[model samples]
Target chain A: MKLTGAEILIRELIALGANKVFGYPGGSVLDIYDMLYKNATKITHYITAHEQGAVHAADGYARYSGKPGVVIATSGPGSTNLVTGIATAFLDSVPLITITGNVPTALIGKDSFQEVNIVGITMPIIKHSYSLRSACDIQRVVREAFYIATSDRPGPVLIDIPKDVQQELADYNQNFEYSMPAKTIKIDLHNAISLLLKSKRPYIYAGGGVLISGATATLLKFAEKISAPVSSSLMGVTAIPYDHDLALGMAGMHGRYAATKALYDCDLLIAIGVRFSDRATGNKDKFLRQCKVLQIDIDRAEINKNILVDEFLIGDVKEILDSILELLPENKNKSWLNHITKLKNSHENLLWTSNNSLTPKSIIESVRSVLGETPVSTDVGQHQMWTAQYYGFTKPRSFLTSGGLGTMGFGFGAAIGACVASNNQRVVLITSDGSFHMNLNELATAVTYNMPLTIILLDNNALGMVRQWQTMFYEKRYSQTALDRKTNYVLLAESFGAVGFKVMNVHELTVALTKTNKITDKPVLIHCLINQDENVFPMIPPNGTINDIIIR
Target chain B: MNSKKHPIFLLVHNHYGVLTRVAGLFANRGYNIENLSVGCTEKPSISRMTIVVDCSESLLDQLLQQLRKLIDVIAAERADPFNSVSRELMLVKITHSPESGGQLLEAINIFRGRVVDMAPESLIVEITGEEDKLNAFIRYVEKFGIIELSRTGLTILDRGQVSLITKSNNN
Candidate 1:
């Protein structure tokens, strides 16, 4: 049972049920590529156009499939290119195992041609990393990497192996049995349940953790059982269906007015799987000022890290919810529901816009109408917030956006990944001119794979978010926010062997969507010209309280 | 609130780049390590590091959590200043002359220091004690025109038999 390190790695990946890998080949990874070539039928390796694209594909695969995405890259720049995608996955808490091939072990510190300290470079961002010292450690390293990547608030983990180690022989017949120690769940549920039952206005604030832990069902059931309204952080948007009676869309800086108000006015806030990010809790002191907060998270570090809570339950969201459900009493707060309903109604027309030019809202709404329940990914900018405000996601993992890092150029690769992960489901990438321009090279990836993805490019010709801030705070002093570029997106897509459309009005947008729907073989890019002055609404100004939301 | 110095101890695998990972964690988090000393432990495979930081209690807690999360790190805990025995080693080179050599020797003897090396006009004195004691010794030796000084930062262990290493049947 002796095998080369490369073969052992492949076997371990197969053992872990990872059949799909995204990567590009390079000199340092030749031995691994050779092994993969020999065992090509076992694993499907998607050779992406760039290392960044490979990592994003893995990230997208992880997000949609609820499995650890595997990616590979060679040494030096090839490894460095995965930095952004790794950071994106790390910040978003996506499970990813990134394997990079390094220069031979002896040439490590000599600044060999393609050697880089990827471990050092990515140390802060990754959950953990290993630089292989010997070929014999490959199996254990791979197992540990996957275990760490997929468990306990999952994030990206990197394993760097030198070229010589990949070619070295190792015994691979050792028993691979390994299991994480069971975490002891400790919580005074009696007190927590009593507190919930006694509250006149109880609100459940769900975040990405609920989705990561797959606790949406429990969350929905708990909300329904207790008759408590549910508000979601941006990352937790799809935890409850948008049409759910108790669902208060997204709650944050650009959150629904009603949702933010509910958080502010609640008597009790049961926060689950959420770090009170600054964008979510504007002016932390004023956010949930009147509420007694009970925060539950798997990571103990997240508890009381931002806003202090009255009590905390530290464990997996699903487990903790199950425990709470067992001890819960039947209760209803009629007045609170009625008040929330009123707030929802009052802000029903808050999102209305009658502009003649194509808008982000109109574009997102059109996509939603045409592609129901389609997985939507977004590059960060005004378009990201607009999609969060508009897209109606009925399931978890259906919406992918870089919430924690707010990374631009993230959607194209992720959308390509989502499409691949979901068996070529009609995936949509809503991006702005600024964000889309960052990683436009990923267009080649979608076209190469013939991924069924639609690119909704909201071309504002400016960094709309920064421009909006400049207008509001910088005394109308416009700086370098404006791109004012003439590079045609339609031509760009067409050159990449994909159908492209340019729409300036809602009529053209709808017509373009209709045409794009017809061309399903390849990716479609729709360039919508939007107003540069338009801004995301209900924005809480920097360092401002949630109460200081600007409706305009 | 004024920052208080806290000594934190960590047991980590003796491997390349482990120190960088530990130091990088503090640097990335904006936590300043006031003093740090690292060396091999009783077990050659394990290295022990003592990092003294001045920060708020909450920030210290975060540092400990982050340190414990590192893959190479086996254990991380704060060394209770009141319940731990701490020491620092300092080597000071003082300018020696016919008139001041006697005074320097007398000062070194009073502070329980030993002259490890000597030249025509300088003596290298080595002192091991608590941080404050070393500082006091240096202060008394400075009048003789001290030329150079080197210090191995604080290393500490709990005063009791409580061990940081997990006990095994073999151990």
Candidate 2:
């Protein structure tokens, strides 16, 4: 069948199993919008208020459902706005596809209106990109983009289609016979097994790879088989069940005190699917210095890129773990396990703040108790750290937050994406006043979609994360960190045609959460005002190890 | 600042922006690319790039792995200095005259070079050999007053029947 490039894009998207697209349309993409109108039943085109929201929604969908999210935008500013969102997905290794329409091929270098070279602009961030000059190449580019975006060590890919290509006629083959490359990387686990068997204090430190590879179950099973206490990075917080006896929550700067301490104490650190980012490993020279590191990851570049490892098994982590489980015999280290259990127990009192005031701890506890296992997303700040420290998630892909990029305005848009991915199932967005202000414009999106999102805005009236750092590191001058954005969020939510409730205490929070759960037709905002003085504690300062932890 | 230079070869799809991806990867990581040469291979769909980057051995290995992950890149590998045959083409233009005659000619002959242009005032000699031999030829004729020089960076091929094409489909 002969079809235009615009129609071909829609057809190819449906063929690739990406039925949901989040984007904002404009001049260059009018032909695509026309085709979308023609094929609205097959693919749901979500119109976000901004391109950033669209890309983030796509990222959220990908993170939630483990499928590449597709987003579209027009040329120039429409595509430029996707930079932050694209970088966020790139840092987190989320599979995302961004399609932007460019000026016609004739006006490419003439500096025509909306003629930006997004392919060049996003070159450093995206996993791969394509600028389509011919309508015939669209099918191949789409397949390759999808394939590269979802393949080993997933990340975002971009395709810039010139307007003329979209309008050009091309022979569209429904079955173009695009075959994926065979996964032929052989795994060698002999050295890893030998190291694990002889080790006394073996600790399993896993990260986002476990979740991305769908190896969460396999990781837990392998951890249980070796009886190794499992501590995860912030990205891998939900990889291991929180209720599991050996799970030591999260391990990083703002990680659980015991988890961070256990890393240095262990003799053998079995890191799986972890890149050991600087945020996670404070001092690279001193991190895991006492222990022999064994890393298992799919990307070979990540092996010694961060910190050198004694032994590394490069391939799919789940495959490597399964092979290890087959031949490795179970071993128990009573002394090491006892020492860790004691550390965890002794550090519990110093973990975080507690009690009934409208605090992060109390608010999170009320929200979690009321809404268990519901997927939660968050923006970056003290509230983000608070949620990571307190909301012990049990389900994989349940705790979606930007770990690598630490994107401030990432929550509300992501929550909206999660809701769409979960088929209108209610999800929570925990954000702070400072972070929420960057993305409050997305509230109109949630309201327009009638998305079932229960937003728990922890308005601290300041950039509490930065304020805490300034208070401790600086002379407590409070510089620009003390922000008092007095926008009435309750009224703001109401203006967006959504329900909002203000809560100052734990009792009010519980009641508001219950009320939001009951109101399923529209999005609900629970504006929980937290104290500005509160900070995410148990923090290991930058370039500081477990020894330099701030407990007070 | 004595930085080690390593030659890396990448087999990539003959598509636009493929070169940019490789260069962008190096630039984005703050790694310096000393020289880069790219051309289409025997396979029209595939192009090859020879890149010399100032980096440590470990950094080259890490970069090779990253380059291989690119969607357009088919395979990437470090050209083993010991096992590979390497060549660099140097085109040097030197101030030449009948006054400063056969010493430059003698040197060019010693390096088995041919003169592409030999004016009364200058000489443009084209020589293709290992970098050391090319540098030696330049040093031998420095008294001739070299005017300009352009050199293609190192390109290598392993001394075996196996090639990156085999590494691509099999590895």
Note the residue pairs that clash in candidate 2. Answer: B96-B122
i-RMS for every candidate (Å) is 1.4, 0.9
Model 2: per-residue Cα lDDT over B71-135, one tens digit each = 78888877767888988899999998887787778888889998998776987999999888988
Give model 2's docking category: high
- Pairs clashing within candidate 1: none
True contacts kept of 1: 0.47
Error of 2 at B28 (Å): 1.4
The fnat of each candidate, in order, is: 0.47, 0.94
- TM-score, chain B, predicted structure 1: 0.94
Give the chain A TM-score for each candidate.
Answer: 0.98, 0.98
Q: Pick by TM-score: which candidate is best?
A: 2
In lDDT terms, how accurate is model 1?
Answer: 0.87
lDDT of each: 0.87, 0.87
Clash counts per candidate, in order, are: 0, 1
